[model samples]
Target: MDKRGRRRTLSEHVILDAALALLAEGGADAVTVRGIAARVGVAPNAVYTYFPDKAAVVRGLAEHLLGRVNHDRFTDPSQPWRDRVRALALELRAELLAHPGSVHLMLGHPPDGPHTRAVRETLLATLADAGLGPADAADASYLVNVHILGSVAFEVAAPPGGPDVGTTRFRWGLDRLLDGLAAHVATGPPR
Candidate 1:
């Protein structure tokens, strides 16, 4: 039964939606089982029925947010590898920036859900297509992930003069990273 004394259907999605709202309103710490339950008009235990605990709620939120990122643009074989990489980074940045309050959830608890894995796989394939061997591709993917996550974290923490400022900084850093990767590829496997 909801707060109004009428029975309401509750599901994981509903709970996650409430949690996300709380997170957006007051950051990660605000997303507790009780808080979510209240938001969704359910008892606190009802939240646990869908999520075992707060960590599970956080993970769900991370996955929910990651699911919003569009990685298809990066999977286009016709596009240049650098362009594909940039598309992916931009997509991730856009999603993270859209939910600035949830950036810490992403940084603190990386999601290993299907959406996250698909994005990672796309990045790995992009690097491989760019001539990076498996090992180098894996390392390069890590570097790219770190850069995107770190940059978004900074932008969220201290918003630049404007959206364009952060976008410019992000593009510059991404370009430099790609430049190094390109040089590495051109040099062939380390002697």
Candidate 2:
């Protein structure tokens, strides 16, 4: 306000949007504090007011993106555990693939926001409902998350001109994982 006589204001959402734009334009390395500040028409130092550092900005962007995931599907009490897990996994995979530029960024820093937590909690609950013990449920949820993130990263890294394989590969892998989980549940806890 002193230098340009204009109001000095920056919202977290605005900063995150600009950062995301920078990310899309290049990659993770493109989304620097200076880059985001320039995009927002503010001094580089101004960005610090909203984000302490570049990592915070990246995390903000991740949260903003993950916030778009529809978790209501995980809330249905009547849905079978397998169906619920598969539905959520497929939806997450599609969402990640839609933002190809972000798949890599997300792999390093998984979402820890409230919405992300809700998704994780729901998955844990589904596993518990499937008769997994508390420890097993926690382990299973971690495995599912890893599979989704790892699969998306793999698909995004494929050659740009390669044939579109749809999701047969993903579905096949997911089915095998679910089969294993089913078998594990059927056997009860190890003696």
Candidate 3:
């Protein structure tokens, strides 16, 4: 340990940065303990000082990428609820599309940090502020995030990558969901 005795011997951040680069160069499959070690010019065992396995590395990458997006797009008191949620959805969609590999990693792995909870909590709080009950708020949050992930997966798995099929479909579906939310918001409340 260093003078402070606080995580001085290892640098998880460096590993994460290198792993992200490898992810961009290829995909999740391109990241391995040996590969990352080579990328960082460290011994293979050096990786185990931080991560336990390849999946753990991917999990870290997922958390890093997800955390980079502005989850606060959900709960900005400055914007109206409909516009806030729509903007949140669209912004998140664009981020995921830019890093399709991270989306895949997130879909396969469970979230392991406060950053992930922050994302969901932001969405949940925004829905509550918009007058949804807890159960309905949860469902609405699920609807938006799931569609984003599902749409990205479909795009990643598809071919003929020139038609914009996935982007067009996801945008249309997201707008329809927003339309339903607007109608609900207009009703004021259920009797």
Candidate 4:
């Protein structure tokens, strides 16, 4: 039973929700098995039934959060490649900023889940559409990820004037990256 005296179901999703709430309330350190179990109206051992350890719980949280990022815009054939990439970067930034407390999880513990793979594949495809061969697309994808994650990590750590300022800076960096990519693609692989 919960604090309201209502019976609560114990499940992976329930545990994850508790973890997210704890993370939002007090950052990653607050998201422990006991904390989650208490929030979910269960014992610490019960949480272990769903997740073997704290690492697994953190992984689950990462997967759950990354699963929420929308990658559909990256697949829209109508848009130019830069526009598609921009949409993806913007959406990822918005999602990360939405959960400032959890941003570190993304940087420190890259989720190895279906959603993460999907986002990677989508970004690779989008780069390929921009005239990158497979090898170049892979390298470009790494650069793009670094830019987005690095920018968001910095913003979350030391927020600029406001979101607008951070976004403006993000756009400028992304544009420069795209411009370089355009030139590289136009010139073809170097000798």
* Better structure of 2 and 3 per lDDT: 2
Candidate 4 lDDT at 143 equals 94
Q: What does candidate 1's lDDT look like per residue over 1-191, in tens digits?
A: 55767787899889889988998798878988889989988789988888888888888888888888777767988889999999889988888888777778877777778888889999999999999998999999999988888888788777556454488988999999999999999997732
lDDT of 4 by residue, 37-91 (tens): 8998887999999989988888889888878887865798778999999989988
Candidate 4: regions farther than 4 A off: 1-7, 159-165
lDDT of 2: 0.81
TM-score of each: 0.91, 0.89, 0.83, 0.89
Q: Which RMSD values do the candidates have, in order?
A: 2.7, 2.2, 4.4, 3.1
lDDT per residue for candidate 2 within 45-159, as digits (tens), equals 8999987887777777888877778888676868888999999889888887777667777766666778778788888888888888889888888888888887887787778
Selected candidate, larger lDDT, 1 vs 3: 1
Clashing pairs in 4: none
- Against the true structure, candidate 1 has what lDDT? 0.86
Highest-TM-score candidate: 1
Considering lDDT, where higher is better, how would the candidates rank from best to worst? 1, 4, 2, 3
